[model samples]
Target: MFTVLPAAGGYTMSENTKVIARIRRLMALGTRNSNPHEAARAVALAQRLMQRHGLTPDMLSLHDIQESVCQNLTSNAEKVPAWLSSLATVVCMATGCRCWFGWHIHTSCSGVKSVRRSLHFYGFSGRAEVALYIYTVLQRQLRADTDGQIAGYRKRRILKNTLRRRADQFREGWVSGVWQVLQSFAPSECENSMLQRWLAQRHTGDTLGNVNVRAAGKCRGDRAARVAGWLAGRDTEVHQGLTGAQAQQQITAGGCTHE
Candidate 1:
């Protein structure tokens, strides 16, 4: 039978257990530090210790595998953009989580009622929280870019239809680029197995669904906009433990939210 161990198992801390704990702490610090140099050093030290101790991914991610939770991130828009869904996919892959669209009824302050959509993330609590935080940051960044694009289009007296099309293309390209950078960090087989088991137990009757995102770059000047967005996404500094530019800054579990 498969056994789950607590973060601190009841037994005395073995030498290897201590090493694992130390490595975990170092990694946490590395991801949270704003100082790039210190973050890099801490990550490197953690790697060295892992190597010294012959630590495997399964061992390092033990705590995560043992615990799972669901986090719902309500979308500001009732109908989420296709790019937003793609962005969530990238975040889920990077953070070892699974995501699905969900909705709840919300009543406005003025007593108006509407359906509010949210993205539900299921994974280890830390991974779910990290996924939510990263999604929020990237969502804002994408919106900001589109807003700037819209402003420029308005200055040039461009049609609203063209502006919307280009903005959508840009967001699509951005998600594609970010996916290239972080897809390698997807969850291991062991983690996936644990997650599937947890889902079966806790999220029974859940079904898989596909989000059909269109290809980017169809209209005139669309290629340029997509290229610009791809470059921006490639340059995006992912502040979490995932492999990317400036691999620092993960919110601690039960930390404050930007929402």
Candidate 2:
């Protein structure tokens, strides 16, 4: 029941309707599937549809859609690293979803204090779902990459303090590099402008915080390792390339059931 008013050269209302229906179905399939492959396929399909029609995630209006707002509580603030939080913000913004952090404070009987942190998402149901899915996948990939780097440093017999410092430096570089690459995936200016107008009319202030990561450090000959990590991060498969129309239609009809 969503209505997307046609902008010049944009998809027709009929096309928008079809796209929105397909997105909802895909989202539902993604949610039900425990395997992340299905979710990734759904995201790929949505990206293809948006690219084919020159549409952004926010272009399809959800005024009449009955999809409810959803929220996910992440790990405690103390456990979540700054780089991870920044990456989450970047993913939410790139996916056209709004996110904020919430802290839950508790005190033990022994007078020790602790805080649990959560990242809250608010937006159209389907987009919010997609944003969380993307964030989870990216976060895992980043951690794996960081672990690999740390293992390599350990193998090199570097001093303990130097190893820790270099690991931190590498992480900072990798996060910053990945963030820069992700920004390239943001919606086009025209689409963003349209989205701003729509949100303004609805009075939804979807603002994202800034992501700040330290510059990658280079210690003597270790610059190559940092550069390699940055390149690998940039090459992370966040979004798949466009598929043929037949493939896209098959995906849409099957609702991401295909492998």
Which candidate should be chosen as best, given lDDT against the real structure? 1
lDDT of 1 by residue, 1-259 (tens): 1112112212322236678778888888899999999999998999999888777554554334332222344244434566777788788767767766654556889999875555666665466766677777777777777677667767886666777778878888788777666643455565577666554443334443444344443676687778778887787755545455322233223221110
Itemize residue pairs with steric clashes in candidate 2. Answer: 76-117, 77-117
RMSD of each candidate relative to the true structure = 13.3, 14.7
Local error of candidate 2 at 78, Å?
Answer: 5.7
Tell me the tens digit of each residue's lDDT in model 2 across 1-259.
0112212232223235676668667766777778899888987786787788776644454332111222333334333445556676666556555555544456779999875555544343255556666676676777788788888777776776667556656555566667655542344454345444543444233333333333334564356566766776776765554112221222222111212
TM-score of 2: 0.46
Model 1 worst lDDT window (10 residues): 1-10
Highest TM-score: give the candidate number: 1
Q: Output the TM-score of candidate 1.
A: 0.59
After superposition, which runs of candidate 2 have C-alpha atoms over 4 Å from their true positions? 1-82, 105-114, 179-225, 239-259
